[model samples]
Structures are given as C-alpha cells and as structure tokens.
Target chain A: MSTLNEVLTKNLHGLYYGNRILLPFKADILKAVIEKSIITDFSDFSEQAEYEIKDNRTEIYFYEYADLSEFITTYETIKLIVVEEGRDIFDIKNHIKLILHLNDGHEIKIEEAGENFLFIE
Target chain B: MRKILPVVLLAFLLFGMTNQVNASDFVNPAALSAEIVNSDAEHSLPPVFMVIPFVTLLLLIAVMPLFAHHFWEKHYPKFSIALGTITVLYYLLVMNDTHSLLHTLAEYLSFIALLASLFVASGGILIKVDKKATPMLNVIFLLFGAVIANIIGTTGASMLLIRPFIKINQDRIKPYHIIFFIFLISNIGGALTPIGDPPLFLGFLRGVDFFWVFEHVWYMWLPTIIVVAAVFYFIDSRNNDGQEKSKEYTGQIEFKGYKNVVYLLIILISVFIDPNVISWVPNLYPLPFGIREIIMFSVVYLSYKTADKEILSSNEFDFEPIKEVAYLFIGIFATMIPALQLIAYEANLLGDKLNPGIFYWATGLLSGFLDNAPTYLNFLSAAMGKYGWDVNNAVDVHNFEIEHAVYLQAISVAAVFFGAMTYIGNGPNFMVKSISERAGIKMPSFFAYLIKYSIPILIPIFILVWLAFYYGRV
Candidate 1:
C-alpha cells in the first residue's frame, strides 16, 4: 500500500525537474530576438552605449535597410554606419557600410577598398 | 478487599501520570543519532527524475528563441522565477536540508563572479587592430587571439578581440569567418591554462595544479592550433577570390579606456590568488570568498563612472546579453544539480573502472549543450571518484594527477575545446555572436552553426584528438 508521503515526494521531485529545465529560458526569450532595427528602442537607453573594449570605441550610424522577410509596411532600406572613433562619429565617410546579404541577404558593405570606397553601382 | 482494590487503582493511575510527566525529559541517544543520519541522507541523491527544471530551462533557451520568440521574451523571466522557486522549494521541503542547495548557490556565486566580472570588465575594452583583410593577416589575427586567449581567459580574449576582427573583415566576411573565429578564439585558444576556460578554473579549484594544463596539454595544444589555423588559412585564401587587403586604415592606431587593463588584471589576480591577500593580522588562513570580486566589481563601476561618455557611446555597450546569461544560467546551475549527481552516481555504479577517451568525449558532448562549467565538474568528479582521489590529501592528489595525467588531460581538453560545438557551449559563444550580430554580422542560428561549421570542421578535429591521444589509452 502506497502512503500519501510517497505520492507527495514524487510530485515534489517532478516540480524540481520541471523548473530546472524551464526557468532559465523563460526569463530571457523576448530580449534575445534581433529585430530589423535594434536601434529603435535602445536608441536612447544609455549615453554612448558602445561597450569600450580597448583604446577605441565602436560607433554605429543607422543608414538604410530592407527586411523582405518582414512585412513591406515596415520594410525600409535601413542602413547603419559605424565609425570606429573620434567626435566625428556621425560622419559617414565616402564609404557606406553596405549590407548586401550580410544579414543573410539583409545588412555593411563596401566593394573594393580605397578607390571604390564609394559605391559606384 | 474491594475497598482496597479501588484505592489501589487510584494510586496506579496517579503513578502513571507522574511517569508520563518525566518521560518528556527522556531521549534515546541512539534514536536521536539515527534521526540525524536520516536528515543528512535526505539531501543525498535527489530523485534522478528531478531534472525537469534544468532540462526544461535549457530546452526553452535552445528551441523557444527560434519559434516562439514573443512568448519567450515576454514570459521567460516569470517562468524562470517560477521554476527556480519550485526547485528551491523542493530542496527545502522534500529534501529536508538546505546544505546542498546552499552549496549549489555558492558555486553560482563564483560562477557568476567569473562570468559577470568578465562581462563588465571586458565590455570596457574596445580593441582596434588595423590589419588589411588578407587571408594571412586574418590567420595571424586568429593566431594572436589563440595565444592571448590563454593569457586573458577566453571570455576576456573574445571580448577584447571580436570587434577588431569584425571591423577588419567588415567587407569580406563569409559565414565561415565568424564560424572559424568561434572555433579558434572562443574554444581552442582556451586550452592551455586554468585562466583560459571555466572548466579548467573549476579543475584548478579541485587542486589540479594551475600549471598542470600547460604541462600536459601543450602537445595537444600546439598541433590543434596548427591544424585549425592552417585550415582557416586555406579556407580564407580560397574564399578571398583575389580580393586585396585594405591599406587606407593606415592611421596610427589609438586606444581608449586603457586603464581598464588594471581592472582586468585585478579581476584575474583575484581568481588566481587566495582571499588571505586581504588579511589584516597576516594570519595564514584563506577567507572563504576573496576581495577579488569586491575589487573587480568596484573597478567595473569606476571605469563606467569615470570614462569619457564618448567612449561608451562609441562602443554601443548593452546589458541584454549579460542579463540573458545571468537569468538563464541560474536556471542552468540550479536544475543541473541532479544531472551532475546522476553522472557521479553512474560513475560510482561502474565500480571504479575509468577511461580517458570516453571521459573526454562524454564531457565534450555534454558541454556542447549544457553550460560547460558544471559539466566539467561532473566528469571530473566521475574521474576523481573512480580513482578515489581524496581532496584533503595533497600527496594523494599529486600522485593521482601524475599517474592519471592522460585521463585528466582528456577531461580538461574535451571540456575546453568542444565548447565551440554550439552557441550555448561556452560563456563567450552567444555573447560573441550577439555582439557580432549587433555590429552588423548575422551569425547563423544554433543548429545552422552546428550543421555548417561545428559538425563539419570541429567534429572531425575532435575525433582526430580522440584517435591520437585517447584511443587505446582509455
């Protein structure tokens, strides 16, 4: 004959097992998605949100991009320009960080260094 | 006689009452000792069935992001908290002891300290190396990362070098480029020392000599680097299609927030040295937890507070990745207790027969899915238990370590090296991916990464390692 205690212990173990596997992924799913424009909400989250790694900081300047996978209503040619350093972070050079299938057919691109630093096509 | 019998009954009842009153003061020492043993046993081996919270948490991390993105993002934290609460409750109520749960949480403290401090400190660095994107140059950069990964630790080295690697190849990256980078920088490069990977750090904590990895792994280390680097060079050369390296990025290289190096040094020293470094009276006892964390975190805070705003703005540092790791890993650490226990139990069940190669692959394969830190501990325990390595005896450990060098080396190499097999394998893999994606490179999905690179490039290399080192030895 099984006791109530046995049943309860079994059930509690179930809870432990269940929660162990489920909780971690639970809190973190929405934040993981990379939408078409990551800059939309976080554009103003912090000042100079670029995490400094070394002697220089990496800066991004949004340009034109189009996510065909996304609804065309939100699909604009969104481009981002990243400048490595200096107060001229806003400055887009003769080069456009072109994205042609860089986002798996979605973002930075420069064809030919130096001379073709500007897009000829 | 009848009158006397009634009186006697009254007297008997009164005597029984008196005895009952004194009985409260009596305790059977044997019974008391038995109860204590029972209490300790309550926490011993949680039902192996209790792996739900851990497995569910990881599976959700693995599958949910791909399919139910919205729900996962919205309800994940709630679900995690709820599940974590349940697990804690099980330990408290069902197990009837808090020691195991408390011990697990303590490991988490060090675990988070290592990850979080690295997260904070490494985020402070923004490395900018200006090499033309030639195949040879890329190979050199990878080699540099491989060496420094041993020095700064994988997480530190990955954070330090990822951006520069991305920037240099901004124009010419194929899917394979980042894939190879994960292969070499995040995984292979971390094989030489305890500081290089979390698994080795855990081993170091287990009294494996800090230099043991270098002494044993050097042969494995040099060849793997040579082969992987060579393969990367070849693939890069063929893929370049005659595209030339850049010359215009020729300005004298500049660095900002160079002071964070001191902070990183502080963090590393804390990891390496004992907490007795903080003793006021100079007595020779190690504090349970060191001031390394206190000093490390303070440096992270001060770096942010004092650094120029431009430095931060330029770097685009965000908290999302670290937060994700923090939240998910708690579940990982908590739920994985039983799994770790199961491995240990199974090893014990095997009656002390052990194998070096099997341990290597087993640890590696499990590390591919579960966070490698705990998995490393699992197989390490299995190995230790099989050999009956008592931690308190320094002579025993030294003898066992030297005698079982190959087995230890296998576990160490497998845990550190195979972490590149998936995005979730090591601490730095996903974050590196996240950072790269943010910088405008689209890293492949988790499974895509496995099918394309890990299974193809890394699996074979692992097999080669197994064949050469562990084939007959196990």
Candidate 2:
C-alpha cells in the first residue's frame, strides 16, 4: 500500500493530467504546490498511486490520516459522472462520492453538495 | 474613459455646425420631381400581386416564431426559401425580369460575405474585463461599443463584447442591460457608417459613398448614444445594491486571439476594394461578385482555420448563427425584389407628396416590424424612384445622395435606429437576445420588449432625434 502523501501525489497527477475536470480553487493550490516543489517526487507521482475508473464514475481510493494539516495540500477531486466533462459544477449530479478509507478502519464519503463538497464520516 | 467624453462632445458640436456639401447645387427640386414622374412611365412595373410572396415571407417571419415556434424553428429555412422561390419564379416566368433577380443576387452575396467574415473573425477574439461593474463603467462600455460598431460591424462587436459584458455584470445583470446593449451596440451604434449595419452596407453596394453616412449621421448618433447611455446610467445606479461583497476584482482587461485583429483590418480594407469606388479594381461583371466579395469570403475561411482553438472554445464559436443569417437572407434578398419594384413605382407616382418626414415614420415603423435590411432597401428604392432614378444604376444612386440628402438621411437613420425597437428588426438583436437568454437572463418577450422597454425607452429617443434632425424638413 502506498503512503498517504504518495497516494495524494498520484491523485493530483491523475487529476491534473488524466482528467479534464479540476476544481478552480484546488487547481490554483495544485499549481502552486507543483511549481514550488513543496511535494517531493511529484514528477514521478504517476508511477506509484493509481486511480480507478469504474462504471460511469472515477474512483480515487485514499486512506485518511489523523492530522488535517497532512491533507492540506491534497486536492479535492470532484468527478462529474452523469454530466459531460468540462461542464460547470452546478450542472453536475449529486452522486459524486469520494471514499476515504480511515486509519481506524472506518470509511468516510465526500459528496458534492450544491456549489460545495460535503464530507460525511 | 471620463476624459474621452468631453473630446467626443466637442467633436460632436463641431460636426453639427459644419455645413454639408451638396453636390447638386444647380439642380432644381421641383423640376427634378416633375421630371422623375414623367420618366417612370417608360418601364413597365411588376404586377402588385407579385408582391404577395415578399409580404407572406415577412409575415411568417414575424408571427411563426411567436405562434408556431416549434414549427417555425424546425422548418424556417424551407418556408423562407419556398416564399422566395415563388417571387423569383413570378419574376422569371411572368415579368421576365432577369436583371432584377441577378442584381439582388449580387447584393445578397455581398451582404452575406461581409457578415460571415466579420462573424468568423470576431468570434476568434475573446475580451475579458475583470473589474467591478459600475454604472459609469457600463455606460462607457456601451459608448465604446457604439464607436466600434462602425469598425467591426454591429454583429461583430456584439459577438465580441456581449459575453464579457454579461460576465462583468453577472451579479447585477438585468434584462434592461441587454436591451440597452441591443439598442446601442446592435442597432443605433451602426448608423454612422455603411460598414456598421447591413442596410447601410446595402446602400454602399448600390453606390452610396463610404464616408457619406459618417459625414451626415455622426452628429445625430452622438447625442442619441449619450442620451440612451445616460438613461442606462440612471437605471443602473438605482439598481446597484445587490452585488456580491466577497468577490475581488483585479481590474485588468485581457484580450485573447489578438492575431484576428489583422484579419479584421483585412475585412475593413476589403470594404473599399469595389470597382465603383476604386477605378483600378476589377468589376467582374455578370458574375454578381467582385474582388471585394472574394477577399471577404476568403477571410471567413482563413480566419476560422487559423484561429486559436482555445479562444474559439472560450467564445463557444460555431457556424450556426451565420448559417441561419445566410439561409434567411437569401430568401429575404430574393423576395424583396418585387416589393421594391412596386414600392419604387408608387413612390415615383406620389413624387413631392412623400417628404422626408413620411419616409422617416414609414421606414422606421416597418423596420421595427419587418427585417430592417429589406425595409431599408424598400424605402431607399422608393426614395430613388421619387427622384426619377433607378436603384440598379450606380450613378443615379450616387446623385440621389447629393440631391435628396434629407430623404436618404431620414430613411438611413430610421432604418438603423428603429431596428433597436424590436428583436426581429435587425439580425444582431435576436442573436443578442438568444445569447443573453443562454446566459440566464430572462429577456422581455416581443410584446413585452415593445411595451415595457423599447416603446418607453427607445421611442422617446427616436422622437427626439426626429424633432432635432428630421422634423418638418422636406
């Protein structure tokens, strides 16, 4: 299993390169992090952590950690499954779910709620 | 922006005081009208019944969208072409008027060429104004749009600016903002130059000088723009409470696809490459299209092909709008021939009884209802007939401008200005409305547009223009 940082690096690389959809806020932060080399081995990120595309959805599985600061640079990816790619978030269906496997064996889901993303534990 | 207003005002004052150059200083008006009446008897006119196709097409254009929208939208091309075919067949089989058909076809080709090139070129340009929306800024934007309409044409300027206009005013973008945009940018702004509007361009095709409209209409255009913009400023200021407080603006203006500016200049320069204007320019007679048209159509292909894909995607550029214009205008140009001939004959019959004031109201009202391009030509044909000149003859058209400046001015002003009164009045009005609606603005309905916005706002302004310039003038 890849480390949390490695998984996030893969996720960011996959989202930034593979997928066309990027949250405007996260896109800015992701750009800054990559540009400043705040995350090491970012250039080689695609080799480690991999995201899965299943059915109509993009499934990115990552284990949750204790400190929120560790996930600060981790970009929240909202995959628009029902709508066409590159459409605004407002046009998206509510079924966008990002599953987070927690350290204590509990799973949490982050869902798109209207204009924002909602975290449910 | 603030500093430019005083200079514009001073220029307007100077233009208003400048004495107009009259080329026909020796020609007597009474003798000319009498002579025109006598000369009209030589050519046998088309039967009045032949005009039904043109009228039917216009009526269908107006009512079908309101009443039979689905049917209209699905099969407008068929109906438009069918009606046009009837008129063309009648002219060919009955009247045997091949010359009228060919001439109109030439005008149609030229018309579509200019519009298509401008539409294609301007589509590649994306202007982003990242600033807080203020009433003054909005007014200035509208004024700036008015000035450039002459350069890029109203259709081009509308396509380039409407999206940015909406984005900047997204927080407080009301339907009136769009209505005023249609008024100033789409219609009224184009009055000062032939390149600005379709009707004026048609005048140019028939042989009006390129600078003639500017020399005559600028004094009138300036005050009208100022007044309408002032009214917009007043209304915008009153409705300024609802902007989002959290949003920050960098106040930077960005332009993408700057290379298209060179293509735009190419189109502008091609406007003057007419055989009639430049003696060296090859005429290519009987072909209906000259060197000018060839250059314009080439630009349409070249600009679209070479345009930056990113800017094209951002603007959501597509051929649908220009395609619609091309198909509908082919029908409009074809059908209007009979109506123009009949109207011209009758106008010559009524001679001096039909004054500049009558031409103003008639052209203005009909233009508001029917397509202004055809209405403009119909009235222009009428005015030319009243002067005993054939619209087909370039020399007659040239002389008509110099001799009967008032009537032509009235028709020209009314055709360009009153087009803002209705959506169907001009091409860009509907395009602006559709684009605004796509952006989530609930634009007023056709009647709602007339009753609530245009009738109240534009009518008073049009009346003021008439009073200032065209009132009681023969």
Candidate 3:
C-alpha cells in the first residue's frame, strides 16, 4: 500500500495522469511491470517520450520512448515491487531498480546508478 | 393573409383575458394598498437594463452581416479588416466597463476556445466521412448532441456539436433543415437533466440535486423526445426527398486525426467537474485551483496540441462565429443582471399563491423569448421561497406529502422544454441559423422560421405532450 506521494517523491522523472504514473524503464520491462499491476491494456509504444519527475528539493525532466499508459501503470507497479522486495522503498534509486522486473517475473532487482545494466543486456 | 388573421385573433384574446383577470384580482383594499406600495417601491428604483440585451443582441446579429458587407465593400476591402474593426469596437465600447472585465474575458475566452475546438474536431470528422454516409451521420451527430447536452449542458453541447452539424450539412442545398436542428438538438433535447439546459444548470447551483430532475423525466422526457423526433423525421424526410443524387466526393472515408476524440472526451468529462458538481464529490480534498477550472485549461491545451491543421484549414475555421457570439452575449449577460433581479423580486411577490401549472407555462413561454437559464432560475427561486424547497429541505419535503414538489418539477420541465420554441430562446439556436445560412441554405426570416417551421411542427407535439403527461397529474 505505497502512497502516491511517497512513490512520486522517489521517482523524480516519472509521468502521471490523475493518480497514475509512468515509469522510466525499457519497453519490455515496462510492459512486464504493467501486466503484473493490471492497471492498463498495454499497447504500442511511443517513439518519443517525456518523463515528469517531482521531489522535495528539485524536479527534473527526461525524454525516452515508451507506451504512455503502460509506463504510468509500470511506475505504480514499481512502487509495489520495491515494498515487496523488502527494500527501503523510500530511496528513489531503489524505486527505479524495482521497476526492472526480470523474467520469472514475480521477482525484481535494483540496478545501481552508474552501473552498466544496459550493456549487460 | 390566412396566417396573419389567426395571430391577430390570438393576440387580442390573450390581452382581453389578461385585462379581465387584473381587474377582478384587486378586491381587498388592504391587500391592494400593500401591492401598490410594493409596486411603487419597485418602480422607484433606478430602472435596470433587462430587455435591452435580448433586444439589442437580436438587432445587432440581424444587422451585423449587412454592416460587415457594407463596411467591407465601401472602406475596408478585406473581410478581416471589417471583422477586426467590429471586434475592437465591440470589446472597447459595448462590452467595456459594464460587467466585470475579468469575468467577461474568462467567459469570452472559454466560449471562443470551445467553439474553435468543435469546429476543428468536426472538420476532421467531415474530411474523413464519405459523402454517402452524411445523411445518416447528420442524424447521428444531432442525437449525439442531444445526449451530450444532457451531460455537459446546452451551451457546452451546442458549442461542441454545432460545428459538426454545420459541416455535415455544408454541402446541402436546403438550410432551413438545420434551423430545425438547432431547435431540437441544441435546445429542446437538453430538458432531461439539470446539466442539460442553462436554467436547469442554474437550478442545480442554487440547491437542486443533480439527480432530482430525473423525477420529471416521466412527464417531460417522453413528450419532448417524441415531438423532437417527429419534427426531425419530418424535416429530414423533406430534405432527403428534394436532394439530387450527386457524386460529391468519391474518396474513401479517411479519418486522419482520430486521436482528437480523446480531447473531446476530456472536455465532456470536464462538465462533471464544474464547480457545482466538484463540491459534491465526497471525501475529495480541496485542490489549489477549482477542479473544473484546472480541467478547462488542460483540455484547451490538449485540443490545441492535438488538432489537425489541415482539417482546420479546410473548414476555414474563422473567428467570426466566436466573435459574434461573444459580442451578442456580452450585451445579453450584462443587461440580464437587472432583468434577473427584477424577475427574482416578482417571483417572491407571487409566493405560494402561484400554481405550478401557471409556473410551468409562464416560465416556458418567457424562456422561449428570453434567455431560458435566467428565466428558469427566476421561477425556481420563486418556487423555492413558496415551497421551502432549497437544498437543505430537498429531503425534508418528502414528509409533507403535498404536491408542492410536483409543481416545482413542472417549472423545471417547462423552462427546459419550451426554451426551444423560438430562435433566440437559446444561445446556439441563432448561431446554428447563421452557420446554416453561411453554408448556403436560404434560412427563413425570424418570424417566418417560427411560423413555418417551429410552430406548426413543435407546438402540436408540445400540446400532445402536455395533454398526455403533464395535464391531469398536477
């Protein structure tokens, strides 16, 4: 039962419509998180995307390509994943990692910042 | 000659009957003295500009095109030049210093933005729809307008729907059909709910429940629908029969901008967020700004970004309609301030002595000529003072077991249903008429329109509705 405020504060560059937030993740990873969350009928992805992030001190903007609704649902799912992983869900970095749910999809891992997770794939 | 005789006869009879009633109704000297004192008090006050707006707006609209063409031809060769001069004159002089500038601006902007969005969206639909699908689409479009009117409001639904109605019938040789359309879809169809018409919307704001109107649907809805549908069917059949089968556009229907539909939905949903409804969303925390105000800005942004430029260019979306509506309504909304004040005072005077049937007919009849929304509120406030039927008392009155609620309901129904009786009755009716004329349908003159179109078709249906449903019950 992660609050929207809590998750929103952690994800500085996330997107939302009403209460739903779009996550920052690879298209496939975002799709997996959305399916698990059961928040949307995930469909085609966008070629250009924008992320809206808000925090206590600063707000940042980012650009990426992903399905909008799916991205939002995945962001919500990531908040749940962080709590379920028994991680300190308050940390923004930990929340971002939790969004990248791996195959055998129930489990998720946090790829630390500045790590070469993109290359490893 | 034939038509003139009946109208004259009816006018004489009405005046005669009213004069007799006034003479006899003044028996008690004490009561008469009190009445005279009250009348003197009302008369002593600085006369408020009430009828000026309605009359002026109608005159300006009728004469505007003539002035536009004249000015354009004589001095400013460009249409835009003439339009600009008129717009400036309108804003600076006519609409200046009379009302709250900020309130007027906000209303004008919203009105313009909504009308522009509808024009663009409908233009997109027009480009995509095949010529063959148009007749069916026209009816469907109007029906959609009727539904939306009940949801957003007559003004909202009209601004959003009129463009598409205009676009669908743009190529038609006959245009009076669209005037009838404005009557039914834009005005009459919105009678079912508080959100449907301005009068009902005002009622909801003053204390009526959002759902309280449904109670009268049994009496009002069935009659309104049958009449409107019958009129639409007749007009549509006449137009179809006269139409020549022309191979207009052979292209396949190609909807380039279906995504804009989402923006339309956003606007439709915003109706529920209007300040009145937002106050009812239980357990909702207060937002920094009004929910409806926020939603309005957001939808405008969405529409501005998503609308297809090509479609807009093709339809030649001009500022004229918005400019015209803004200019006319400025006078209307301004002068109406006093008219409404006087109406409120009068309704208070009538108090509980006013019968519901009388309220129904009077309110409806007045609404047909004057703006229905204010007329509705005027009668509603009168009913409330007499019946003790404000929001707090809404539930309490059930225990009284009287027909006071029924009378109130009748007032509500009549205000909404009969508002469509004349062209000037609703804001969009005249706009639709102008748009149709612009598209080349020799629309009838104002009186001609009522006599030939609305009266013959609508009045009979209205009578049938009254006889079958509203007559005996109350």
Best by DockQ: 1
Model 1 error, position B275 (Å): 4.8
Please give the lDDT score at residue B401 for candidate 2: 92
Runs off by more than 4 Å, candidate 1: A1-121, B1-42, B241-247, B275-289
Candidate 2 local lDDT, residue B255: 85
lDDT-best of 2 and 3: 2
lDDT of 2 at B46: 72
lDDT of candidates 1 onward, in order = 0.59, 0.65, 0.48
For model 3, the docking class works out as incorrect
Please report how far candidate 1 places residue B126 from its true position, in Å. 2.7
Q: Give the per-residue lDDT digits (tens) of candidate 2, residues B1-474.
A: 342243223223212211231322111110111222232353367778877877787677667767875466557777767777777677556655454555555556666777788888987888888788899999999999999999888988887788888877866778899999999999999999988987787788678898999998889889999999999999999986435456777989988888898999899898878655567876564355678788999999999999997677555465655656666666766676656666556665675688888898888987886567656766777788766787657799899999988888998999999999888788788777765653446567677788999999998988898888877887
Evaluate candidate 1 and give its CAPRI docking class based on DockQ.
incorrect
Candidate ranking under TM-score, highest first, comes to 1, 2, 3
Instruction: Write out the backbone clash pairs for model 2.
Output: none
What's the TM-score of each model vs. the native? 0.72, 0.70, 0.57
Model 3 Cα lDDT, one tens digit per residue, B1-474: 442242223222212222212322222110111122233343332245434544555554445444553342122212222332333234334433212222222333334344444443443332334455244556666676777778756655665555445544543535555665676677877877865775665555445666777765645675567557656665666565324546465645444456666666666565455433454633212111234445555665566456676544333333344444444454454334344555656777876667666777778777777667656656765666575654223343332213456766767777777767776677677666654443334456666767787788767876776666557563
Off by over 4 Å in 2: A1-121, B1-44, B201-210, B240-242, B369-404
The 10-residue segment of model 3 chain B with minimum total lDDT is B25-34
Off by over 4 Å in 3: A1-121, B1-128, B131-141, B152-172, B239-256, B274-276, B279-291, B389-403, B472-474
